[model samples]
Target: MADEEYISVEEVASIMGLSVRQASRYAAKVRTERINQRVLFHRDDVMEQARLKGIEHEARERAATYQPKPTKTDLVPAGEMLEYIRERDRQLAEVQAQLNQALLEIGRLQGQLTDHQQIRQQLTDIQSERDELKQAMERARPWWRRILGHD
Candidate 1:
């Protein structure tokens, strides 16, 4: 086959409006290149296949009038995008402030709990000391003798 006569499977598929597999099947000859390891098919065979399938005219018509869909990045202006970013930053700052306040409240509650625990331990110790003193006094003298100040 002549060098100018052969076309890649991808180009054949695009021109004939068919998948690469379908184009490969329809093409007359599949050529393999050793240098780049590329596959190519005959252009005339692809065109003949499209004509036989009665889609050649339709494919050309579609290709002539095709328009790509617009994307968000293309439609949005730069100033509005900047404003959206600023609004997001403001919301983030507000959330951060709330988190800090919650942390401070947790610390204060923990300190109060520690203080209450210490007071409870001191009360327990005082009760035990009072009981010991009462036992000593009772062992030394009877109740009536203690009331009369006699040992």
Candidate 2:
């Protein structure tokens, strides 16, 4: 409050690990400023809140570099990974080929089905025509032939 310097809620949220809305709520009792629609609080007030929440502002220096000791089972060898990928790819290719063949077979079967349907329709038409012709012939027979049961 003495310095009158204001920090944006975004900085407070980053330092405190709280959301902007939460930081704004924490800064409610502090002096605030609005610049370009950003809610800002006095820098000292933000630091005071952080201190009261038991969060120290000090950065600890690491004494030594970190070395990971992962077990052998944790990592896969590059050669084995490559071989597995190749096998998966081979299986996928075989499946794709089979799928293509199946699609072709389906298309051929559909064509055959269409041909059979057309043949059935043609046979029906021919049978209907034959029946009509036989009826016409019966009508053309003379009365004497009809009485004698001759054609």
Highest lDDT: give the candidate number.
2
Alpha-carbon runs more than 4 Å astray in model 1: 1-65, 141-151
> Residues 54-112, candidate 2, lDDT per residue (tens digit)?
77353001102213345586688879989999999999999999999999999999999
Which stretch of 10 consecutive residues in model 2 shows the poorest summed lDDT? 58-67
Index of the highest-TM-score prediction: 1
Per-candidate TM-scores read: 0.52, 0.48
* lDDT for each candidate structure: 0.73, 0.74
* lDDT of each residue in 1-151, candidate 1, tens digit only: 6775666666666777777788666533444333277676655565566677798786566445545446678888899999999999999999999999999999999999999999999999999999999998787787789789776
Colliding pairs, model 1:
none
- Which residues of candidate 2, in runs, are more than 4 Å off? 1-76
